[model samples]
Each structure stands twice: as C-alpha cells, then as structure tokens.
Target: MALHVSLIDFLSVIPRLYPNDPDYFCSLCLLSTSSLCPECQHTHSTHSCPIGGLCDTHRFHIHCLFNLYVMLNMP
Candidate 1:
C-alpha cells in the first residue's frame, strides 16, 4: 500500500526522539538515516513505540502494520 504521508513527514517526527548528529542509525528502522524511517510511511513515533517496543519501527499504520506482519509471519 502507498503511504499517506511523505518521507519529509516521517523525517519531521524523528529527530527529536533520536540524536540528530548525522551519524546514528535511523531510529525508525534501525537503518542509516539522520532523520527518517528507512521505509518511510506515517508510523508510530519512537515515543509511541521504541526500537524494542510494541509495533516498533514497522512503518505502516498500527493496524495495517500488524496485519501485514501477521500476513508475512514476521516477528
């Protein structure tokens, strides 16, 4: 499914939760991004779900992400 928001929208929400020093793994997906999810989509911010928290960085809407995860049998 296409995302409702753009990469910029995702980036706008990330910096505050993570360090913005341009040398950290993307907080949103455990990837390399100074400020953006590796797979950008409007997802739960790091506050709502940390790296090891429920619904972590999977970037679909909560319900949608859950459904996809189930469909794919992902952890």
Candidate 2:
C-alpha cells in the first residue's frame, strides 16, 4: 500500500502523538524548505527547483570561469 502524508498534516500530529519527544523531527522537511508546503510547489527561490535546492546554476558559472582561466593561461 502507498501512503501520502502531507508535511503539514504530519508535522501537526507529531506534537500530539509524541508529546514528550519535543526534539524528535524529520530532517527532510527541515532541510528542504518551501514557501509554506504545497502553496508554492516547494521552490524556495527563482533558481531553485522543487527537488534540488539550487538547480546547479552556480556550477555552470564555475565551469565558465575555469575555462576562461585556462584560455587566458594558454600561450
């Protein structure tokens, strides 16, 4: 069977179910942030994606810089 539990619904019941376990938590939700859950489709910023935080936009920039550095060094 498959279970679909929204982050919002799951977080709500956690406090009640485990009242004494205040510190208990899921890292996925904490590590991954959305506007408020489902409202914004979980994209934090313009360059961010729903799954990967910062959609590798910076990696390409770094690659370009490296290429430029190599080109400038070559005789």
Candidate 3:
C-alpha cells in the first residue's frame, strides 16, 4: 500500500517563507534584526493574523482583529 497526500494538505502545510508583496510589511512587530512580534514580546517570531490571509499584513490587538474582520466583510 502507498500513502497518499491531498492537494489541500500540501497547500496548507507550506509556509509563506518569502514576503510576496513589498506593500505588505510584516504584520509581526519585527525585532531590530529578525522578523518578530514585539507585542507578543517576540514570543512568536511571525504573527500571521487569525484572520487568515486577508489581514496577514496587519497586526492588531484581539479586539481590533475582530473589528477589522467585520469591517473587511470577512467571516
């Protein structure tokens, strides 16, 4: 028997290693050297917003994140 992988699984597991757009700065509050979120006290080096890819370029407090999703018409 052979193991099989789904397309969705492959897509989901791959991280966005390279920044695609220059307009979109790192959402994480980067450290002076490395990409890091100062808000999280640099605990999480990259802060991909919970809003999925829509607001990945923007970082917010928990409340702000919720409001932004609503404003942007994202579920």
Instruction: Return the top candidate by lDDT.
Output: 1
Clashing pairs in 3: none
User: TM-score for every candidate vs. truth?
Assistant: 0.22, 0.26, 0.24
Error of 1 at 8 (Å): 16
lDDT of 1 by residue, 1-75 (tens): 444454455446544555544344433356423233343343346456433222233233344434434544432
Best candidate, TM-score-wise?
2
* Residues forming the 10-long window of minimal summed lDDT in candidate 2: 51-60
Candidate 3 local lDDT, 1-75, one digit each (tens): 323444455335424632445455554433322233334323232345332222244333443434433444533
> Model 3, 70: alpha-carbon shift in Å?
0.5
Query: Alpha carbon lDDT of residue 45, candidate 3?
Result: 29
* Cα-based lDDT for every prediction: 0.40, 0.34, 0.38
For model 2, how does the per-residue alpha-carbon lDDT over 1-75 read when each residue is reduced to its tens digit?
Answer: 224555456435534543333354333233423332222333344343322221211111223323434554555
lDDT pick, better of 1 and 3: 1
Off by over 4 Å in 1: 1-13, 32-37, 40-75
> On a 0 to 1 TM-score scale, where does candidate 3 land against the true structure?
0.24
Q: On a 0 to 1 TM-score scale, where does candidate 2 land against the true structure?
A: 0.26
The true-versus-predicted C-alpha distance at residue 18 of model 2, in Å, is: 0.3
